[model samples]
Target: MSTRNPGSLIARIGASLIVLGSASAFADEVVKIGHAAPLTGANAEWGKDTENGARLAVEEINAKGLVIGGQKVTLELDAQDDASDPRQGTQIAQKLVDDKVVAVVGHMNSGTTIPASKIYSDAGIVEISPSATNPIYTQQGFKTAYRVVATDAQQGPALADYAKKTLGAKSVAIVDDATAYGQGLANEFEKQAKVLGLTVLSHDATNDKAVDFRSILTKVKGEHPDIIMYGGMDATGGPFAKQARQLAIGARVLGGDGLCADSLAKLAGEAADNVVCSIAGMPLEKMPDGPAFEQRYEARFHQHVQLNAPFAYDAVYIIVDAMKRARSVKAADILASMPGADFVGVLGRTQFDAHGDLKQGAISLYDYKGGKQTLLTVVKM
Candidate 1:
C-alpha cells in the first residue's frame, strides 16, 4: 500500500484538465481556478451549490472573451470533491497543485478547508473560500487563504449572544460533531457564552457517521439547559435536531451556518420550525443577482439554491476579476493580484485583508421557522 501527496494527485483531477484547457489556447497563458467540496455522499447539496456558483462564473467570464494582460484568455475551474473529508481534501488539493490553479474557491467545509489550505499555500495557490468559516482558516498566517464570508469566531458568537440575551437561555450545553468546523465553532461559542453571562452546563461530540445521540443528549438533557448549541455541518445537524425532539429534549437547538439550509426543513420536519442557526451570505432570494440565479438554477437543476451559493458565486468572480486585472491568466499573476483587491459582490462590497480574511466581516443569522430559511439579522464584525 502506498500514499500519494496532494501535490501528486493534482495532475489527474479536473484541475489538470481545466489548466490544460487554458494552457493549450494561450501559448502558455492560462488562468486556472480550482474548487473542491462534497459533491457526493450525505452533504452533496452544498457541494453542488458551490459548483453551480463557480460554473456560472466560468460561463459568464468565458462568454465575454476575458481580456487579461492584453491577451484573450479563458478561465478554467479545476474542481474536485473532498466529500467533506479532510483526507479526501488532501487528495483534491494535490490535484489542484498539479494543475497549477492560480486561484481556488472551495473545500466548503471548514474542517477540510483549514488543512487543505496548507497544501495550497505551500504551492502558492490563492484560495478564497466561499463558505468555510472556522476562525483558523485564515488565522494560520496563510496570506493566500481567503474567505468571502466571516469566520465562526464572528458567526458563532453572534448566535450565542442572541441565544443568551434574546432567547433568555440561562443554562446552555454545547455539542459538536467533533469536526474541525464543529468543534472549532463550539469552542468559540462556549467561550462567548461564558462572557455573555450564560451558564455552561456540558459539552458533547458527534461525527458524520453518528446516528445515535441518545447517551449524549440524555446527559445534556439532564443539565436542563434552555438550549443545545451544536456545531457541525448539516449532514448531521438536521438529524440531531429531529432526534433531540424525539428524545423529549425541549431545549432549542442552536447552531452556526452549517445547519442553516432549506433541506433541513425536510430532514427535521416538525423539529425544523424552532431550530435556529447562524447563516453566512444573504438568502438566495435576496441577493442582488439572486432572483435571476434562483430562476436559472431551478430551471437547470429543478432545485432551489442553498445558503452559501451566493458566497460561492462571489468567490469565482473575485478570481476572474483578478485575472482581468493582472491581464494574465498565469497562476503567479493571479496570486500576486488577489491580496488587498476590492470587488463588488453579491454580499455587498468586499475586500481581502493581507492575511486573506475579509476586510470587513460579513455574515447573517437565519432561522428555519415555518419551513423556510428567513433572515433574522445581518451583522458586520
Candidate 2:
C-alpha cells in the first residue's frame, strides 16, 4: 500500500465526489396528475378544453420549477377520454387510480361524474369535478368527492327566479334529456318554479341524443307557456330551441349551465336569440385572473375556452397547492390537505364547505344575441 501513488488515490476520490454531485443535481421527482373527460364524443370540444387547461398548468409549474419535501418535482398530466359514457368514465377513473395520480380533475358531465366518483372514493384519490353540477355528487358520504362549480340546487332556483322576476313568466313548460344531469336540473327548476308561484303546464322527457324536437315542441306550443326550460347540454338544447322557433313557439327558451356554451349561438343560429341560460360560476371575464388566463390559454392551445378550462386550470393549481402544504406528493397527503384549501387562482378565492362544495359560489346568467353570448347578470350565493 505504501508503494502505491498517493496521487492516484486522490484522483479516484475526487472523481467519486464529482459523480455524487452530478447525481444530486439531477435528483428530481416526477409527479402525475390525472384528467378525465369525453375527449372523443360530441362533448370532445369541452373535454379537450378541460385537458388543455390542466396541461397548461402542468407545463407552467414545471417551467417555474417546483420543490416539494425539499426535492425538485416535475408534474405530468395523465388525460383520458371518458367519451361522456358512465361506464367509460368508471373505466377511466380506475385507470387513473392505477396510474397513481395524486389528484384528478374531470368527468365533465353529471352522469359520468356520479358513477365514476365511487371509483375515486374507494381508491382514496381526490376528484374535483370542474363542471358536474348535480347536488347528489357531494351528497354521497365520500370525502374524496368535490366540485368547483355551483350545484343544480342553486342554479335551478336562480333560473326560475329570473324567469318569474325578469322575464315575468306566469306559466312554464319543462323538457329534460332524461340523463342524471338533465332530469336532476329539471326537477330542481320545477320545484323552484312552483315555489315562485308559476304554473307548471307540462314536463316532457327526451333522450339526450334526440335531434328532432318537433314532436315535443308541438305539444309545448299548445300549452302556451310564457317560458320553456330545457334541462340538457347545448348539443341538444340548441336543436330544441331551433325546433321551437321553427314551430313558432312564443315562449323564450331557458336552460341551466349545461346549455350556456359559446357554441350555442352557432348551434341554434337565429333561434339562439331566444335562449337564456345560467352558468354555474362567474363569467370568465369577471374572474379575478380570467383575462390573463384566457390570454395565456389561447396562446398555449390556439383555441378559446369552451366551458370548463378555467375551472380545470384552477383545479391543477389547487392540487399542487395541497402538495406544497402537505410537503409531500403522496395521494393520501394531498387528500388530507384538500379540506383546508383556500388558494386564490384563476376563478378567484377557492374554499370548500363541510360537504366539499364551494362555500361561496356564484352563478352568471347569459343570453344569446346575434349569435353572441352576452352576460345578463351574476348572482352570488
Candidate 3:
C-alpha cells in the first residue's frame, strides 16, 4: 500500500465506480405493454400501422427516460398477431394477460376487440382500442373496455344523414359481412335510414371472407336502390364496390370506418371514386398536430399513415400519462387513473365518458377522388 502508484490507485477507483454505475443502470424496471392485432391477414396493413404508432410512442418515451414511483423504468411492447379472428383475439388477450402486461392497445377490428375485452377486464388490465367502432364494445359495461374513436351508434347515423342530405338518396340497400362489426354497423344504419325516411330496399348478409359479390349485386341490381351501404372492412368492401360497379349497379357505395382507408383506392380501382365513407374520428389534416405527426410517421415508418395510426399513437401516450400521474407502473393503479385522463395528444383533448367511450367524438366524412382520399367534412358528435 505504501508503494502504491497514484495513477494505478486512481484507475482502480475509476473502474469500481464504473461497475457501480452499470449496476445502477441495470436496476431499471422493465414494464410490458401488450399490443394485439391481425399481423398476418387481410387487415395486416392497418394492424401494422397501429403497432408502429404505439412503438413510436414507446421509443420516444424511452429516449427521454421514464421514472415511475421514484424508480427508473423501461417500457417494452409485447405485440401479438390475432389474425383478425375472434377466437385468436381471445387467445392473444389471455396470453397478454399471462405475460402480465400493464395495459393493451389493440384488437383492431370490433369483432375481435369485443370478445377480447372480457379477458382484459378480468385481468384488471386496460384495453384501449384505436379503431374498433362497434357500439357494443363499450356497452358491455366492462370498466376496462375503452375506445378512442366514436361508436357505431354515432357513425352509422352520420353516414345515413350524409346519404339523405348530401347524396340526396331516397332509397338504400344494405349489406353486411355478418361479423359483429359488419352486422352491427348495418343494423344501426338501417335504423337511422328508416327514421330519415330513406326507403330500405333490402338488407343482405355476406361473410367477411367472401370475395365474389356478383350474386348479391345481381340481387341488389334487381331492387335498383339509389345507394348501396356496405358494412364491412375495406378488404371486403372494396371488392364489393368493384363488383357492384362491374354489374353496373350505378348506386354509389357507402360504408363505415371499416370501409374507409387509403388502400381502398387500390383495392377497388375506379370503383373507389364512387365510394363514400366515414371515419370514427376527426380527419387527420384537422388534428392539432396532424401535419407534423404525418411527416414524422412517414420518416419513421417509411410509409403513409393508414387509418387509426394517430389514435393509436395518442393511446400509448395516454397510457404513459396515466403511469406518470399515478406514480406507479402497476396495472391496477393505471386502470384506476384512466377515468380521469385528459391528455391532449395528436387527437386533441382525450377524455373518456362514463362508459369508457370518448367524451366528445367527431366523425369525418370522406370520398375517393382520382384514387386518393378526399375529406368532405367533419361532424362533431
lDDT of each: 0.82, 0.93, 0.93
- Tens-digit lDDT track for model 3 on 73-171? 899999999999999999999999999999999879999999999999999999999999998999998999988999999999999999999999999
**Model 2 pairs in collision:** none
Candidate 3's TM-score reads 0.94
TM-score of 2: 0.95
lDDT of 1: 0.82
Measured by TM-score, the strongest candidate is 2
Candidate 3's C-alpha runs over 4 A off are: 1-26
Error of 1 at 113 (Å): 0.8
Global local distance difference test of model 3: 0.93
Estimate, for each residue in 68-100, the C-alpha lDDT of model 2 and write its tens digit.
989899999999999999899999999999999
Question: Could you tell me how far off, in angstroms, the CA of residue 108 lies in candidate 3 after the best superposition?
Answer: 0.6
Residue 170 alpha-carbon offset, candidate 2, angstroms: 0.9
lDDT of 1 at 52: 85
How well does candidate 2 score on lDDT at residue 246? 86
Clashes of 2: 0
